[model samples]
Target: MTDKRDFAHIETWVFDLDNTLYPHHVNLWQQVDARIGDFVATYLKVTPDEAFKIQKDYYRRYGTTMRGMMTEHGVRADDYLKYVHAIDHSPLEPNPAMGAAIERLPGRKLILTNGSCEHASNVLARLGIADHFEAVFDIIAAELEPKPSPQTYRRFLDLHNVDPTKAAMFEDLARNLVVPHDLGMTTVLVVPDGVKDVVREDWELEGRDAGHVDHVTDDLTGFLQGLLAKG
Candidate 1:
């Protein structure tokens, strides 16, 4: 556990919406991922097998598959965002305890997701934490550039007037925390609870040791509650 002193100066809590806010076990993101594959196959006129390879290759190369597709294929960002986000959000169950913990924290809360604002909203609403956040900085707001991109982080900071030194960022992907850490924000990596290999990919789980993550927790609800206790 990270000491309260580590985050004592934080005034803005920026959380990644997908696995950071909601438990990864909820599996809501699997739906969006499937849709991404579907989009790739349909748009590229490629076989499903080929699309899978392309999807991952693009994701690895561009930080996000959507960014890669746009760069190489000139796909409309809105169309892709809308298509990918149009999925059932029922897998997310409300976590009133976590929401309460978040609400009790000092200062404003915001969501910074590689996902769309609509998707973030749906996830937040489903988790019953939408009201706790002051605003959302999504891929659209990021101009289709995703996290880990220094420019995207800078754009988010500029848009929100957030001082990195006074902010803390929580993300499920270790890679996404690099820029925030570089900018002086406290970065907490939210890991999946129990049997991670079953729920996450090898690549997504590879960056825990790159020296950027400041804290880690598998239990988001307990971690937030613990932060409240630390303070």
Candidate 2:
């Protein structure tokens, strides 16, 4: 995490979507995962326990289970995306507060996510903030490389013409933000109270209590407002 005082120094802002876009209390991810689990159970013919483990392992090995299935098992990316994000969007209503926060942010805003473009777009549209970001770089943009991969971060910088010193990253996943921190970009970990409940153990290795992160907060609206005020 970079110093809050350095907020004025950044000229670009990058954000991770999903839980970071709205409060984790929304329980949006759980719904998405249920779809993934269902797909695994049916396709792999595995028990729920085995499906979960296999999903985790695939994510660990290929940065994303979709990528793992694509490379190892020849699963089609479009087919995988269609299957996983086919959930009902009715539960994910529009978030005016989140949209307002996005409007308040400084510099260019970009959505960086491990999910595919289709998934990202559907979520953003459901949240009613599809127009907030200047660009949406999804898993497909990264060539299927997911978060926590230094190469994906590098590609992000190159593709977007983002200067590390002039940018800050807001991510719910601490490990995913580590590379950005190492590369001299400000890192903000958005751990909204019980938001850490669903985070995996290995991903939560450093835990949210570590003071090394530039900033930790439960409220993204407050954080964005504070940055604007500081500037």
Candidate 3:
């Protein structure tokens, strides 16, 4: 199976978890957000109202709430992850179809996420797709550098021994996809509804259209199926 289309050039496929792999409307993010709020309130001795506001502020400033907490609030990363993910994992359910799709995809697959490896592992296990990826690059894996930063993409390429030109990045966030596109990797955006707004970032190479991402789709299984069919 060989075709000259853009996505066919990718020898390595990097996936952003969370909203990318699964449907975002599932409301899982709200649970995680609430956990962060609870953690902040308990550990920082702040009211729940103040804690949620500060946590959102941290996310806006540092990309990840843990980053701000570690830098300014002096919170430890492991401690924060432990506290935040202590919430109910029942919201996550196995997706055998996604797992099968992952197993069938050609080339190497890796997960690059801003979340902790513990969280990535738990989520993957819950999704039943943990065995498909060769490696999991989480928040700690990139030295705390998160998405939308070219540094994280560079670090991911280096750490995974991947060539940027031969890789494809699948992300739900358009802003995070910018650096990958700038680095010469083909970008795929997964918008489950086909109605979500794209996120704009500050570091994207100006004049290059973010809409020119190689492909956009509603789900990982459909995306992978389309990619395989193109081969």
Candidate 4:
């Protein structure tokens, strides 16, 4: 657990779409991961093993593998998005509790994801919370710039007219929260529950004392419920 902070001033709730909205154990990313590796392999004419390495390298360097592809090989964003997000979304169960909690929160709710809007829509629909969000600020909306990039965050805020001081950003990756924190938004990191020996990706791991993070939780629905309770 991380230090908790007051969120009463937050009026715009910005949520990341993937692990932040759904639990990590669902392993949905595994499907997308393989697809991305396959795409990279096909594009570069490399072995799957080599493609996997490239995928991680790109993710580390460019915030997203697709961004790397676009920058390096001029791959079409739409084509890559269509290919990677074709996986089944049944792993996500409909979360009515989360929907209700989000509905109870005051002001606007928005999704800010490094993924495509189409992918975000599918996940939100599967969770039965698609209608709860006012709008989705996706990779395309950010002009291919991904999270943790100050430019991407700036674009989202400008397009949506969101006030950083009155916003709260929820994300699974701690590194992604740094820019949001610096911009005056409350930052929350969502981790898996009761997992003592969890294996994390290099990007997912962050120091607990990092001042950018304000709160941490495993249960997103319950966390939002608690926030609403405080009000």
The digit string of per-residue lDDT tens for model 4 on 46-84 reads 999999899999998999999899999999999999999
lDDT of 4 at 52: 88
Q: Which segments of model 3 are wrong by more than 4 Å?
A: 1-5, 194-209
Residue 106's lDDT in candidate 3: 77
lDDT of each: 0.87, 0.79, 0.78, 0.89
Of 1 and 2, the candidate ahead on TM-score is 1
RMSD of each candidate? 2.1, 2.6, 4.8, 2.2
lDDT of 3 by residue, 57-87 (tens): 8887788788888888789888888777776
Candidate 4 lDDT score relative to the true structure: 0.89
Give one digit per residue, the lDDT tens place, for model 1 in 1-231.
543328888899998888788778877778888999999999999999999899999998999999999999999999999998899998788889998999999998998889988888788888888899899999989988898799999999999999999999999999888889888999898887876433667878767656788888899889889989989
Q: After superposition, how far is residue 231 of candidate 2 from its true place, in Å?
A: 2.7
Tens-digit lDDT track of model 2 for 1-231: 534425777878898987788777676777777887777777788999998888878877777778777777778887887888877766678877778877777678998999877878888898899888899998888887788889999999999999988889988877787788888888888875664555334564454655436888788888787766776
In what order do the candidates fall by lDDT, top score first? 4, 1, 2, 3
Candidate 1 least-lDDT 10 residues: 192-201
TM-score quality measure for candidate 2: 0.88
State, as a TM-score between 0 and 1, how close model 3 is to the true structure. 0.86
In candidate 4, which residue ranges exceed 4 Å CA deviation?
1-5, 195-200
> Which model, 3 or 4, shows the larger TM-score?
4
